[model samples]
Target chain A: MNRYSLNQATTKYWPLEDVVAASAKAELDWIGLWREPVQEYGVERAAKLVADAGLRVSSLCRGGFFTATDDAERRAKIEDNRRAIDEAATLGTDVLVLVSGGLPAGSRDVDGARAMVTDGLAELAPYAGERGVRLAVEPLHPMFCSDRCVVSSLGGALDLAEQFPADQVGVIVDAYHLWWDADVYRQIARAGDRICSYQVSDWIVPLPADNLLGRGMMGDGAIELRRLREACDAAGYDGPVEVEIFNQQLWDAPGQEVFDLAYQRYTEHVA
Target chain B: MNRYSLNQATTKYWPLEDVVAASAKAELDWIGLWREPVQEYGVERAAKLVADAGLRVSSLCRGGFFTATDDAERRAKIEDNRRAIDEAATLGTDVLVLVSGGLPAGSRDVDGARAMVTDGLAELAPYAGERGVRLAVEPLHPMFCSDRCVVSSLGGALDLAEQFPADQVGVIVDAYHLWWDADVYRQIARAGDRICSYQVSDWIVPLPADNLLGRGMMGDGAIELRRLREACDAAGYDGPVEVEIFNQQLWDAPGQEVFDLAYQRYTEHVA
Candidate 1:
């Protein structure tokens, strides 16, 4: 109970104020925040709201799409990432999740795209470290490799993160994105202190038309949720266990109902 | 091209006889065969039809689904695989591509499922070797790891293959599946003589309703087709470069049109 943090995206339509009020009512110690909504409600206000409600931000949703075709575009993306770092700092969260951009449009140069991700991290790690914000690289499922993130496996994410100091650049372990990997357990173990966040969501098949919203609730799909959570625990990750699902069905449901349901499922399937 | 092989699945709607006749007319030395269609056409007759057309069978479509919950079910799948190996022997092809089955219906034990695959391979390897057929383990994309094949990377497939004699068990390097893997080239190089087949198909985004048919034609997606082919060559794999695409658009197109288009793209993007 002490470690549970409901990522705002899990109940996307839930208003920021209502979510904060609900988390406080439910006596939650932490809540995950997204950049857009936090900014929309005013970052300072949102920060104050959470702090006033006796809640802390577990993590900021994301900021990394560094794969661009030219120097100017790449530099601009890096600059945007720096602002994201500032946002994380303002929110008082040490972690900012990153979904590394996919291949540059019309390019089959995957290696080149990966190099851009490495360079982006190198450029941002020091800045992030100074701000006490860890850029947590989240490896998306391989299905999203061509269009969402070139870093498609935990090992691949670690490969990029290892080039930097652990406190500065770490990785996120999202079960929805990594449950199918055979090497995932070993990678999670290898992640050790570098694992900045642990997220949980099950994977259901016959993915929806929009694959981005295909995640299932914790107990409803085939993932060994508790097993993965335990693996993260064994690897020395004692941070908030965030529930970050992106499903149309879940989003369409009533916010409080979904939040309560997710909490129950987390206890039954992941905690 | 001496190394070209037109996998029948690429032009799936074409009658097997016509695919054979067209390959003969095109002066191709090799043609890939699928199990159900060949079985429907009478295995002996199909074999004679192919041999009579002066075409050698490059490889048989599949022969694995070894993951099952009960002992009886597991044994039945193994028995079916025996029949498939016999069919491959009758067709005079030495390669029997295996798409290892996914998890048991409601099970989340991925490691247990993988162990079943390894045990299944151990049981079939000697029998397959005796029939002069090499069991070629095909690692599907991680997207298919849940409902289709659990083996999801060249390195993972090789991990299973290395447990047996190379002549008895090998791996398939399909560009559609392995192209996104960061360690793909290294795994291909490690494969060495354990490489039994190399299949090609491009990967396109916004996967269709049925992801099994999401494969794109070469040059239509972001895969580095020629680069992968060159890597296989560098790894000492001189076997047939089988063109295998499974797109609804390609299936609906005229057979000869798709066939000709595939050949052109194979030359432009893969050869």
Candidate 2:
């Protein structure tokens, strides 16, 4: 319970105020946030709201989609990431998760897209480091490789992150995305202090109509959540264990109920 | 088109007789068969039908699912695999593709399930070799790791296959499954002569309700089909390149129409 944090995505429809209040009421030490809701609630107000409740911001949801074919589009993405870094800084969170965008439209050049991600990170790492924000490269499940994130493995993410200082760039080890890898334990050990965030979500089968919302709550599917959390701890990641699920059924539930269940599952399956 | 083969799964709804006639009429070098249809059409009759038409059976669709918890269930799966090997032998196809089953019911021990796969292969490889069948372990896309196959990468599959003689065991380089892997090129190079079957299919986004049927025709999605085929060729595989797509839209189309479109796409994107 000391390390448990409820990522806002677990209760996506929950209002920012309600989530912050609920986390504090539940006596949680932290809450992970997304960029959109914080901006909507006013970044300063959201920051003060959490600060007033004595809850630290564990991480900011995202700040990358840098793959683009044209120069202007690429520059625009870099600018957007810059704003994301600023938002993370303002929110007082050191971790800004990055889901590097997939291949450009009508393009089969995966190598070219990967290069763009490396370039995006090389440009943004210094800016993020200056603001005390660590850009956490999240390797999405390979299922999302074409349209969501080109970085599809922790090893691949580390390959990109090792190019920069560990404080400037790190990797997010989300169970849902990486539990299927045979080399996951080895990579997790290799990650050591490079693991910026450790997120837990079970891998459920018969992924819904839209696969993006297919993540199951911890202990609800086929992931070894405790094992992975232990692996992170073994690798020296003494950080918040964020429960981040994106299931439609969980979203349809009451926000408080979802939060309570997430906390409970984190206790039993992750923490 | 000398090396082109139309896998029957691309037009699953087509009758076996029609598919055989169409492949012969299209002047294709070979036809890939599924176990169920070949069994239903009578293996001997189907074998004679293809042989009489001057076409060869490039490979058998499948022969694995060995991750059962109960001893009886495990034995049943091994028996089924034995039958599948016999079917492949009768069909005159040297390659028998194996999709290792996922985690056992209510189990999260992926490592344990993988061991079951290795055990299954070790037990069956000699039997398959005696029947002149090479057990080709296919590493399905990781999305299917929890349900359809536990072997989720060429490297993982190789880790299992390398324990057996190259003549008894090999790997399938399916473009749709292995394209997203960052280490795929290196794995393909390591596969070298261990490559038994080369499969091609494009990976389209917004996967359908049943994600299993979401594979698109070659030119309709994100896979670099030509590059993968070249990789297989460079690995010393000059065998038939099978176009194996599992799409609902393509299945609903006329068999000959789907076949013609697949041939064109394979010519432009894979061959």
Candidate 3:
């Protein structure tokens, strides 16, 4: 329970105020946030709201999508990422998760798209570093490689992150996205201090119509949540274990109920 | 076109007779057969049908699902695999593709399941070799790791295959599955003569309800099909490049129409 953090996405429909209050009420030490809701609630207000409730912001949801075919679109994506970095800084979170965008539309050049991600990170890492924000490169499940993130493995993320300082760029080890790899344990160990965030979610089968929302709650699917968490801990990631499920059923549940269940599962399956 | 082979699964609903006749009419040199249809039509008859049509069986569709919780069930799966080897032998194809089963139900031990795959291969490899069949271990896309296959990357498959004689065991380099990995090209190079089959299928986004049927025609999705085929060739694999798509739309189309479109796409994207 001491290391448990309820990522806002677990209860996506829950208001910022309600989530902050619930985290504090639940006596949690940290709360992970998303950029959209924090901006909507006013970054300063959201920051103060969590600070007032004595909950530290664990991380800001995202800041990448660098793959684009044209220069104009690529520049625009970089600009959007700069704003996300600023938002992460303002929210008082050191970590800003980046879901590196997929290949550009109508493009079969995966190498070119990955190169774009490398360029995006090179452009943003220094800017993020100055603001005390670590850009966490999240390797989404390979299923999302075509339309979501091009970084599809922790090793791939580390390859990109190795180019930058550990404090400026790191990797997010999300159980649901990585549990399938036979090399995961080895990669997790290699992650070491570059592990900026350790997120726990189970891999449920028969992924729903919207595969993005197919993440199951911890202990609900095939992932070895505790084993992964222990691997992170052994790798020296003494940080918040964020429960960040994106299932529609979880979203429809009462905010407090979802939060409670997440905390319970974290204790049982991840702690 | 000389290297092109159309796997029967691409037109799953098409009768075997029509498929064989269509392949012969298309002037294709090779065809890949699935176990179920070949068994349904009687293995000897299907073998004769293709042989008489001047077409060769490039490979057999499958012979795995080795992970099972119970000892009795495990033995049954091994027996089934032996029968699959015999079927492949009868069909005059050296390669028998294997989709290693996922974690057993009520199990979180992925490592244990992978071990089961290794054990299954060790037991069957000698038997397969005696019958002139090379067990081609296919590392399915990681999305299917929990349900369809635990061997989720080319490197993982290579690790399993390297344990046995190259003549007895090999790996399947399916572009649709291995295309997303950054380490894929290096792994392909490492495969060398252990490459048994090179399969091509485009990976489309917004995967359908049945994720298994989400594979797209070659030119319709993001995979760098030509690059992957070239990689296989560079790795000393002068084998047939099988177009194995599992899409609902392809299955619903007229068999010849689908075959024509696949040949055209394979010419443009994979050849």
> Backbone clashes in each candidate structure, one number apiece?
0, 0, 0
lDDT of 2: 0.93
Q: Estimate each model's TM-score.
A: 0.99, 0.98, 0.99
Off by over 4 Å in 1: none
User: How do all the candidates rank in terms of DockQ, highest first?
Assistant: 3, 2, 1
Model 1 lDDT per residue over B1-271, tens place = 4778989999888999989988898899999999999999999999999999999999999988889989999999999999999999999999999999998999988888999999999999999999999999999998888888899999899999999999999999999999888989999999999998889989898899898999999899999989988999999999899999998899898888988898888889888
Candidate 2 lDDT over residue span A1-271, tens digit each: 4788998988989999999999999898999999998899999999999999999999999989999989999999999999999999999999999999999988889989999999999999999999999999999999999998889999999999999999999999999999999999999999998999999899988899999999998888999999999999999999998888899999999998998888888888887
DockQ of candidate model 2:
0.86
The C-alpha lDDT values of all candidates are: 0.93, 0.93, 0.93
**Proportion of native contacts kept per candidate:** 0.71, 0.78, 0.88
TM-scores of chain A in all candidate models? 0.99, 0.99, 0.98
Q: Among all windows of ten consecutive residues in candidate 3 chain B, which has the lowest summed lDDT?
A: B1-10
Candidate 3 residue runs with Cα over 4 Å from true position = none
Q: Could you give me the TM-score of model 2 versus the true structure? A: 0.98
Runs in model 2 with CA error above 4 Å?
Answer: none
